[model samples]
Target: MPDHQQRIAYLLARYADKTCSREELDELFSAIGQGDGPEGLEQLLEEIWQARHPAPEIDYEAVYRQIKPAVPVRKTIPLKRIAIAASLLLLAGTAYWLLPSKRTGKQATVLIQPAQRRILPATNKAVLTLSDGTTVPLDSTGKQLIQQGNVAIRQQNGQLLYASQPTDGNIHYNKLTTPRGGQFRLVLPDGTKVWLNSASMLRYPTTFSGKERVVELDGQGYFEIAANAQQPFKVKVRDMEVLVLGTDFDVMAYGDENSVNTTLLTGSILVKEGSTKQLLQPGQQAVIDNQDHQLTVKTADIRKVTAWKNGMFVFNDMALPAILREVARWYDVDIVYKASPGAELYGGGIGRDLQLADVLALLEGNGFNHFGIEGRKVIVLP
Candidate 1:
C-alpha cells in the first residue's frame, strides 16, 4: 500500500479499536476527503471490517457530535459523492466505536438490530390526469397515451413527452401526479424539461397559445424552462407565483412543510406572493412562511437543496423529526415516534437507492435512537 493508504489503514485500525484521539479523527476525515480513489479505500475498509473480531458496543452519536466541527470541507464534491464516502464509514461498523459518555465518564454501549421488514425507495412513476377527469398511469415503459389534434402525449425512457405543433384555438390541460414513493420526469410541448419529486403534482396546458405560458404546481418540482422571449413562463403554487422568461429553478411547496421554498439556479425569477414581489438571482433562495406569508431571500445551499434530484439525501444539521419525515416520504412508510426525539440535529449524506432497513441501520448506528419496522410503519423506540 502507498504511504497515504497505510496511514488510512492505521487510522482505521485505531478507529475500530476506539483508541483514536480527536486530532486523529480529524486527520482521518481529512485524509478520506483528499483521497483520489474512494473505491479503493472503500474496499480496504470492507476488508478491515470483515477481518475484525467482535467488540464491545460504542456510542457513535456522542462521538459524531464531538467531532462534527472537524469534518473536512469539500465544497467541490457532490452530495452523492459524499454519500459514497459517508456510507462507507457508517456501513463499515467502525463509526459506532466506543466513546465515553459526557455525563458518566464511562463508555456507553448501544446495539441496534437490523429491521425485520424491507421497504424500497421511490422510483419513476406517476399518474396523468387529463382535463376531463380521465386518469392514466405512467412509468418507464414507452407508450402513447392520447392524441389531441396536432398534439400527442406519450411516455418514453421514463419521461412523459408532449409532442405537438401549433394547434387550433381549443386548449386542454393535464395534471401529472406522483405518489408517496414515486417520482417522474416530463418534457413539455415547448421542449421544457421537468423533474417531479415524490408526492408532487404539476398541471399545465397541452400546448402554449398565449403570450404567457402558465403552470400550476402542488408539490416539489425542478424546472428547466424552454427559452421563448415572446412568451414568458410562469409557475403558480397556491397564492405565490414564480415568473421567468427562461430559467432553471426548484420549487418546494409541500403542504406539510411550514414554508414554500423557491431556489433559483440560473437566470432571474420574479416571485409574487399576492401584491408583494421579490426578484431572486441565481444561487439565492426565496422562503415564504406559510403562517404569515412573509417572503425572504437568502444564499442557498445548492448541493443540499438539489441532492434529491440526484438520488441522494443530504442532511446539513437537519432536525431529527424533519429527517424522519423525509425518510417516510422516500420509503413510503409511516413514522411513529414512541418517545420525544428532542431537538437533536443530524448531518450526513446517504444514497436514496438503499432499502428502508439499510437506511434505518445507518441512522440507528449513530446510537442516539433505536428503530423498528412493523409492516409499513417505522417505529422510533425510547
Candidate 2:
C-alpha cells in the first residue's frame, strides 16, 4: 500500500456501510485511478494507523493493502518489502475477471462477495384456501395444519398435509400454488413429502379414493414416498402417470407448458403417459413431452435440481431463464427483462435469503445482464 491506496480502502470500507459522507466517497474513489496505483512500503505509520483504528480514514494505502494476495516465505527478505511486493500482486479488474463464470464477469469473486445482501425481487404468491374458505398463508413459518371436520389439512414443514382416515373416503381436494417467484413444501397423508417450485401448483384429493395414493401435480415437486408395495404411490401430472412403490424423486410436471422432468434419487419407479411406460432407476431423469407424447431419459445432477427443498439455491450449467426462474420463486418477485439476454448457461451459488438487488448485482457483475427495481418488480435490463 502506497499510503494513498490504503486511504482509499479505508474510505470504501466506511462508505460501503454508509458511514462516509458523499464528498469523502467521491474523493476516495478518484484516488484509485482505475483501481490501481504504484505499490511500495506504506511506512510503519500506515500499519500502526490501521491497527489503532478498526476502520481508518480513506486512503490509497488501505486500498492496495486489502486487495493484495499473500506470498509465501523465501530465503532472506525483510517483511516490510514483502508487504509492498504483495500489494502489487493484486490485479486490475480485468485480470481478476479472467476467472470463468460460465460467462464473462466485470469483477473477481472477492469483489463480488459483499454484494450478496440484496433487495428481494417482486413476484406473485398464492395461499391455500381450504375447503372451508379459510386461507393459509405460506412463508418460512414452519409446519401448520388447519383442521376441517374429519379431515386434517395442514402443512408439515414445507409439504402439504391431508390426515384423512382411510375408511372415511371423503373426497376433498387441496390446491398448492407458487406465484411467479415463490416456492413451498408440503407433506402428503401417505408420508410423501413434496417440494413445490416457484410459479407451480399441485392439486390432490384429501383422502386416497382408490386402492392407490394418487395426487395431481401442476408445477414441480420432490417426493419422498413412503414405501407401500401393496398400495403404490402415483403422481398424475398433466396427463402422465408416475407410479412408485417407494422412492425419493423429483417431478417437474408443470402441465403441458414445460417438460416433465422426473428425477429419481433412490429406488425404481415407472413413468407412464397414456399408453407409454418408462422405467427409471436412481440418478435417471425422465423428461416427458406431453404435447408430442415423448419421454426421454438422461443422467442428472440431483443436488442442483433438488436444492430448493433444502433451502439452497444452486445453478449448474443452467440457462439464464432457468437460473432467474429459481431466483424469482424463492425471492418471490416478478421479473421484467430490461433486455433480451437469453440461453446463456450460468453456474454458481447464491442463497435463497438474498435480496433482489444483490441477486441482480451478482448477475450483472458476473456478465449475465443488469437489473433494476421498478417499484417492487425486478426489471432485468438486458
Candidate 3:
C-alpha cells in the first residue's frame, strides 16, 4: 500500500475505535475522496472491520462465509459519517470501480454525507385552492379534513385523499400546488392517484359528474389512473392533452423546457397537441414542441422518467443547465452560471433526499468543481 493508503488505514483504526478527533475525521473523509477504486476501499474496509472486531482474526473467505449463509443483518459500520461522501463520488462517475467488487451488476445507492453547508431535501408540502377561492395549507402528517359538499379531502402522511359522500348534480373544482422545495401526492375523487413533483400544480374536480374526467396539470406529475372506461381520464397540459383510461403515465410540462413530455408506463395514452395526435405504448414517450405544437413519439426509459416519484434524480444524457434547474427547483435555490457546458450529457442516479451541498460535491468529484454557494444562490464558476 502507498503512504496515503497506510495513513487511511491508521485513521480507519482510530475511527472504528471511536477515538478519532474532529480533525482526524475530516482527514479521513478527505482521504476517502482521493480513493481511486474498490481495491483501496476494500482494503480500508477490511482494516476497519478488523479494528472493530479485533478478537476474530478472520480472513476474506471466512468473512464471506459468515455473511453468505442466511440473510445477513445490516449493522452500522465505521466511517458512517463519511460513507455518503464516498458513495456520492462513486455516483458522480468519479470511479465506477469504487463500488464493491462483489456487486458488479447491482444498482447504485446513495449514502448520507456531512457537508460544510447543507440544504435539506424537499418535503411533502403543498397548498390547496378550493373552488370557493379558499386557501388551505396542507401538512403531510395532519389529520385535518376539509369537507366540501359530498367530498371529503384529508391529508395523511404526505398523501391527500378524497373520499366520496352522497353527492348531488353540482361539481366543484380543487387545485393542489406544490412549491419549489416541495412535493405531494393526491388521490382524486375518482380513485386516481397522482404524484406531483416540485413546482407543479394539479386542478381537478371534487366530484366527476361529467362524461369525461378532465384535469389540468402544470409542471411534472405521475399519474396512476383508475380503470374507468366509461369516463376516460384526460390531463390537459398547456396546449397538449393526454387521454388515458386505466393507465400509468408521467407528464413533464415545465415552462423552462421547450417541449412537453408525456411518458406512458403501463397502459396506452393518446397525446394530442394542436391538431397532431400520437398514440403512445408502454415505454414510449410523446414529446410535444411548445412553440410549434408538433408532437413526436419515441421509446423512453420509464425508470429514468419516473425516478423523481421514486425519490431519485436520474440523469440520462441530461445537460448541465437542465440538471441544475432540477436542483434549483428541489432545493429552492437560485443558480448563476458563469460558463455553460454546452450539450454536455451527464448520466447518473442520486437520491433526491440528499442536501444541496452534497449533490454539488458529487458534481465536483465528477470534475465540475467550479461552483460556489452563497446563501441560497449557487454560482457556477468558469
Candidate 3 Cα deviation (angstroms), residue 48:
12
The residue-by-residue lDDT of candidate 2 on 15-88, one tens digit each, is 33334553564464344332233453244334544554444244444433332221223424444443333332
lDDT of 3 by residue, 1-382 (tens): 6787688778766644435554675576566654343455656654555445443443433332322211112223233323433332232212221111111222212222234277787999999999999999885676787888778888898889999665687888899999999999999888899999999999998988768999999999999999999999999986788999899999999999888999998989988887787888899999888787778888997767987887677666676788788999999988887766444455555667777776775554443325677777887765
Stretch of 10 with least lDDT, candidate 2? 91-100
TM-score of each: 0.77, 0.65, 0.72
Which candidate number has the best lDDT? 1
lDDT of 1 by residue, 71-148 (tens): 354655444434433433454532222222111222223223345445789988899998889888987774766776
Comparing 1 with 3 on TM-score, the higher-scoring candidate is 1
User: Lowest summed-lDDT stretch of 10 residues in model 3?
Assistant: 95-104
What is the Cα-based TM-score of model 2? 0.65
Q: Could you give me the TM-score of model 1 versus the true structure? A: 0.77
Sort by TM-score, top down from the best: 1, 3, 2
On TM-score, the candidate that comes out on top is 1
